[model samples]
Target: MTTKMVFAQPQPVLDARESDEWTSGICDCCDNKPQCCFAFWCCPCFACVKTRKYGQCLCLPLLDIFGPAHPATLAMRVSMRHRYGIKGTICKDCAIATFCTACAWCQMAREMDSRAIPIALVGTRPTQ
Candidate 1:
């Protein structure tokens, strides 16, 4: 007798167009006054908090001063965009990271908090 093994395929959790939703814009920080104040007054701490929430080291954002590239900020933005399948270009991400780092970070934090369900935890599953 011969035996065979089979593996189940995963399903798509969201609809095709679901990923097209726009994220919170960078200047929308005032939508949440407390969070806005935190980000504005303590940008480094806020950035560190946001980085840690993404499962990275809390102090990782401090690396931004090492260069104009703002590697840590870029990584967070890229990861967030990929996780949510958000429609955006790398040029935009780089520009935001390079010119408006604080606003970018604040927007990311708001996006993550505003989502009813965290994108990262929305695994592949059947859509009702």
Candidate 2:
């Protein structure tokens, strides 16, 4: 007797367009005014909030201040790009994280917000 094994094919989670490029530009803060304003006024707080939203520890972004390389920002940006299948190079991510830290955080925030999926819970009603 011979036995055969079959594997299921993987399906994409996000739409095709989402995988092509960033939803907004690094400097397109106008795409999300409130996020931009918050990022501008309190960058650390904004970074912390965005970091938490990305499923990282709330204090993750605070580590960026200790090092000149802004490691936290670079990591977040690279992770986001990879998760979303956005086309970008690590060198570009490093440059953005190093030079435009606030804009980078804001761009990530906007991308996450745009791709957010709402969850709906269903409960059975009690009989009268």
Candidate 3:
């Protein structure tokens, strides 16, 4: 059985998500600074169980559009849909707006460039 890493202090000493040394080695969110946390499987960030406001990541569009959803992300979707009713389902366009990734809506997670913070410009969906 896989046991989750529970931190007593709820704060990581060194934030890997904020580290900028490695493009993929460190956490993706650790661009400004080191993202110290007590987890690494799904992701390492300050928005984990300790963040108090973290109910779930709930962006199903990202999972569906991006493919190969992580367990944490899936959990967030379930919570967002069933518990909080954030959104039943979101499209790629919505996720891009929600995640501010309109310019970098990558098809693959590994293809996401940590440094490439696309200009957060608003997008208008193409007419059908």
Candidate 4:
């Protein structure tokens, strides 16, 4: 079945091309790709997302909001972490994390609390 994306009228006037400023993002669980309507956010692609699923959950910091990985995801991850002077894996174990299962790396780190200096800013709310 096709999911229809919806949008609400903006409370404030918005640039007609306002969407242009936003990167296209579908939840990891979303099967719908840009091949279908964008700006039409449906519920998180629940069926599409799975726990411990590879290639889900990670978002581009400083670029888009909670969104899917982009084509430049690898570069983005490296550069963003570097920008933050964020060395080492954000996940627990201070383990080195390669690109795949980026979310898992972070998830495990959170669960173990083995995260290194400056807990990973990804995954959970900042620890108080």
What's the TM-score of every candidate structure?
A: 0.73, 0.80, 0.23, 0.20
Candidate 3 lDDT trough over 10 residues, lowest sum: 102-111
lDDT of 3 by residue, 26-122 (tens): 1243332322222222232322432223323434333434544343444443343343222334453245334533111221132233323344545
- The local lDDT score (0 to 100) that residue 69 gets in candidate 1 is 87
Question: How many Å off is the CA of 118 in candidate 1?
Answer: 7.1
Clashes of each: 0, 0, 10, 5
Tens digits of per-residue lDDT, candidate 1, 12-122, equal 474333655456778988888888888888888999998888778999999997887898898899888887778889899999999998888888998777554534554
Reference-based lDDT, residue 79, model 1:
86
For model 2, what is the alpha-carbon lDDT of residue 54? 87
- Ordered from best to worst TM-score, the candidate numbers read 2, 1, 3, 4
Evaluated against the true structure, the overall lDDT of model 2 is 0.87
List lDDT for all candidates, in order. Answer: 0.81, 0.87, 0.33, 0.30
3 or 4, greater by lDDT: 3
Summarize candidate 4's per-residue lDDT along 1-128 as a digit string, tens digits: 56654475335432232221112111231333341222124212311222113234433222222344423334434433443344444442122223333342233222222222332333434323
In model 3, the runs with Cα more than 4 Å from the true position are: 1-43, 49-52, 55-68, 90-128
lDDT of 2 by residue, 55-81 (tens): 999999999989788999999999998
Report the Cα lDDT for residue 27, model 3. Answer: 28
Q: Residue 126 lDDT in model 3?
A: 39
Candidate 2 positional error at 116, Å = 0.9
